[model samples]
Target: MTQQLLLDILPGALPTLETFVAGVNHAAVDAVRTLTPGHALYLWGGQGSGRSHLLRARAQDPDGHYLDARTPAHWLQSLATDEDRVLTLVAVDDVGELSDAAQAALFALFNRWRAAASTPDAFALLTAGDRAPLTMPLREDLRTRLGWDLVYRIEQLSDDDRAQALHDRALQRGLKLPDDVLHWILTHYDRDMGRLTTLIDTLDQYSLAQHRPVTLPLLKALLTRQHPDPASHHADAGRTSP
Candidate 1:
């Protein structure tokens, strides 16, 4: 199936530029929004630093495409070369995890994209990784291609940013999350935005099921139920990275 179709069927949060808390990554976010065709932007940062969120937001564009480690680079070429294709946005996440075969395919595709850089049909490429392009464990040539245009290190969100994000999320769900409740989660649970958001979604469902408003009590009950042992709770939170 096409990447667009796969994205349509996948059930998950739909990240957008509006939802992303720029924190210290405003430049990175702006670059995504004003991306020029044929240019590639490489973003690197710790887990939950909004790399994937930015990619997904750009992918939401009608002319945008999102790919990950699971997608073979050959498939990328086919999509890029589709007869009726126009200027497209290609967002590749977790470049460091691509397999050897995929790496070779990406290398070839990169050259093609670069060769067409000055053309009207040039494709915009964006990629994210755990580390900078040069530091990634990939072929030297591929690494160069990954960083050919621009590179940015995504800054991890500050504590205040996390709190605000949590607040915004609660409001989106029509829940008035108390300041105390927000404080409790940020203080006790993992701070990773991805995991924290998932937790909030779970709480939303649990609140609906139990016919109770979102409160500290409801959150506590769900967390305790989800992780019976206190030790296991902390362990699980620590294990949840971006």
Candidate 2:
């Protein structure tokens, strides 16, 4: 089965606990996967570190609700007022980017949730940020609230991890992406997993469309068409500059 074929069987790529490549974030992954109501989980990591992925996975459950920290405060407050709502999980992404009003609202909601911590079906809060909770620029009280639960730092994946991930993903698609090809990709493009995965998917599609196996030459052709050399752009600009 080709990668495109595998993708065609599904609606689109959906991040789930089963699909996550937990390099050093195993603790965070496990907590999000098994967290019960009334508990809270805070995850912090750099871009492409799988913070959003895990948060989304937790939110995939029937009783889970996902929100961005940047979501308007008035809207988040509305969720807090629903005393009869069955909110087993609430995952908030990018907690560090929350606006002032949103921070205030989250602070209030956190206090309310804490008060009901003893309830059997209490709502749980999960959040992610680029930095640890204490280091975030949020309100002091909210920062404290963010750390009131289990906290884990999602570690960034090393180059070796990314290579292994690419290999693993390719194997799953019944494709044997060569070591040289994978190495070429890593050396030439952004090492961020999210972008790399997208590139892999595009390569798969392009290879299928062209009836060609994935190879270094094919990758070079594809990338060249997509991104002209920056040096060329600079030369053109220099020629036209006043």
Best by TM-score: 2
**Native-to-model Cα distance after best TM-score fit, residue 12 in candidate 1, in Å:** 4.7
Model 1: per-residue Cα lDDT over 128-226, one tens digit each: 899988899999999988888889999998999899888888889887788888898888776557667767767777788999988888777776554
On a 0 to 1 TM-score scale, where does candidate 2 land against the true structure? 0.82
TM-score of model 1 vs. true structure:
0.79
- Which ten-residue region of model 1 has the weakest summed lDDT? 1-10
Steric clash count of candidate 1? 0
Candidate lDDT scores, in order, read: 0.73, 0.72
